[model samples]
Target: MKVMRILLGYTLLCSQLCFGQSKLHFIVFADTHDRSLGQTNLKTFHDLSSSIGFVNTIATYAGLQPNLLLYEGEKCNPKEIDQLLTTLVVGKDDVIFFYFIGHGWNNRQNNYPSFIFGNAYTDRATLETISRNQYDIYRRLISKQARLTIVIGEACNKERSDSPPVISKREIEIMSPQPYDPLKIKALFRNWSGGFLLSSCQRNQFSYSDLKGGWMSVAWQNTFTELCNDTYKRKVDWQLFLTSVQSKTQKTAEKNEQKQMPQFELSILPFNGSTPVSNIIPKSNTPVSITNAPCPSIDSYVNETALAGIREDLPLLHEMYDEIDSDNAKEYAGAFGLFFQNQRNFYNKLGSMVFYEATGIPDKCRPTFDKNTKWVFDSTNEIYQRISVINKYTSNPNKLVQQARSDLPSIISRLEEILEKFDK
Candidate 1:
């Protein structure tokens, strides 16, 4: 009877402890457009997609899915962001992961950094007008039952003066709302728990991007993917992950002849450590696509030395096609051969302008070159579209195969014009 009584008492205690445990949640926002750069919107769109994949991958591994993932284009304003935050009910046992990717700037007047989104504030708006009541949402989040919070800012503190002229206008400056001081915020929660702030770059430094996406985005994705793939299956450590991301971002920046490095600030309750990353992540058999096949290095397409690297990679691309052909993978080989062939043909067709585009072209010819390249890229993208169609069609019916054959001649004719133009 005593043993039975003890067991009953223990079971109730276990139930209470289990019920009190907090779960993990995430909130992600990528304000990809503010009009400071001509390509900022497009870049941010790509970044947002990548961010979604990163978060989703982690959640899949951890077992718990994100509570909310919000991506805003031109319509996301401060009020809208606050409203979204209000929807979440954070608990003391829960951990919140917040991510922002866009232009960021330090408001000297306010002594805080802000992330700029489309319609963040009017051009003439002062710091007080833009940042007023903005950070209260974050404050409210931590003040509640949440035990840990992570904030990742993939934004620039200043407009990169060295960014290519083709990317942005000289007249516009896109910046984020000033962020709440990390130390101060941590102090507020010092007795309660801990929070981490990961910034893309240090103060006075600007973040960078290429056609692929922002370097910081690439770094985070890479680090997370590698961690997931690690053989040890060890617990996830933020410090270790951040260190790896910083290294990767710095190397990428240096290779592109840019200077940008990620930075972080961590403050958490010093008591029993927070949850092990492995505790949240589950084991999965499927491989992550973002980490498995990364986007081609875009920096190689952006500079003279990098252009040479692209040229050197052409043979490898052809080799990839040949390997597929050797395996009698005709359907895939055609797509592979055409995709790289189109990329090479497009670059060669443009000639010295590729270099000029990466560097600086004369103002007179700049617009013309930009127009031509855009046309070239659009047409080349069709090859990728066909590849997708080919992938979807099965061999049993082969109707799509016949359609692709019918479309080939027109595609050839369009490609031929570029050669003809070169000959002229």
Candidate 2:
């Protein structure tokens, strides 16, 4: 009898440890004190707060703990962020979600935008001191090694400039009650393992907002609420969620006579645990089609202008091969060579495809285009970085190098123009 009682006690302890509840750490940073964007920022905060509450309620129902750390108005500064990062502790089963909404701009050094925590009263130097880039924050959060890390920054990704205040009579509302299955919620939150980084707009683009809130934020909250309330869906598809958010945001921006497109990077690892396969939501398996088809201009430019530009630049690119002295130079030369050689064939295949008027590329071909464009962007950026390094080495740069450096920005701009036409 004594041995059986000891065995039963040990079994219960093991069960408690094995089935322990996970935690969700949500952090929000909002620059609500900025005079120009104060109202919009406040509205964003309220919307996100309600969203967090709904998440918390669902998490409780699913037997998970939820915690929120909010920094807004005067507290939204570098010092506070540093302190939060230093003290925050995350378990392996925990989820870390960091969101920021404020004025931001692209420094041209990276694809992501830099947050501007300064208000109208703050000076330029002080503003620079307080600013932090979205990617940096994402990296820091991921370093904590939580089960899942999601970082979202909803701000303009253009050159540094003051935006005029936007006014709207729309009022904020809390998330309404809906029939949500706790088991589905648990699967949605617990089945994923990876990092997700999202930005409001592409590089050199401006994000729009009004007193109601940021277009991206409002769209995200709405989509997320809908997903949670959906009882029929057994698993959450992140790719679909991102696509929905992007489409809703673009529509909202268009309604206001502005153009805004959200961008994201998702890296999901396969699950190898003992959890049932039914509960696991694998990474981005579902195909996501673009909401708005690419404009006719993209097809015309790629075939008529872009291909010719590449052909013309091929000779110069080949000539630079001999001047490649460093690893960076070699990499740049190689990437440019591949780009010039394959661009014609790639575009030729695209040109041959019959595009639908309503949906640019067919569902099967959209992924190929997306993958190729991403490679182009990455290769172009790599070439740019190599040029910067080569310039440092050669104080008296050669003519070919100088010309390549000067023309690279135009090339990037043209690429951005083409990508914009994709409506992604």
Evaluated at residue 206, the lDDT of candidate 1 is 77
Lowest lDDT 10-residue stretch of candidate 1: 280-289
Residue-wise C-alpha lDDT for candidate 2, range 206-291, written one tens digit per residue: 87777668888888877777776745564576777888789888887677767789999876564455333222222221223455
lDDT of 2 at 263: 94
C-alpha TM-scores of all predictions:
0.47, 0.58
For candidate 2, the lDDT comes to 0.62
Task: Give a tens-digit lDDT track for model 1, residues 1-424.
Answer: 6995675456445533543344556665566565654255456555444554544433333333346556666544566566766777766556677777666564321112457644533442332234322123344555554666777776666422223222312222222223122222222222235565677776556777655566776777666556544242554455667788899888877776668888775555443445433222212111222333443222222333223333434454444433443234555545544553334333333333233224323345446656655755565456445534544443422454454454454444444543343322
lDDT of 2 at 360: 35
Task: Give Cα distance to truth, residue 338, candidate 1, Å.
Answer: 52
Off by over 4 Å in 2: 1-21, 50-52, 162-177, 231-234, 270-424
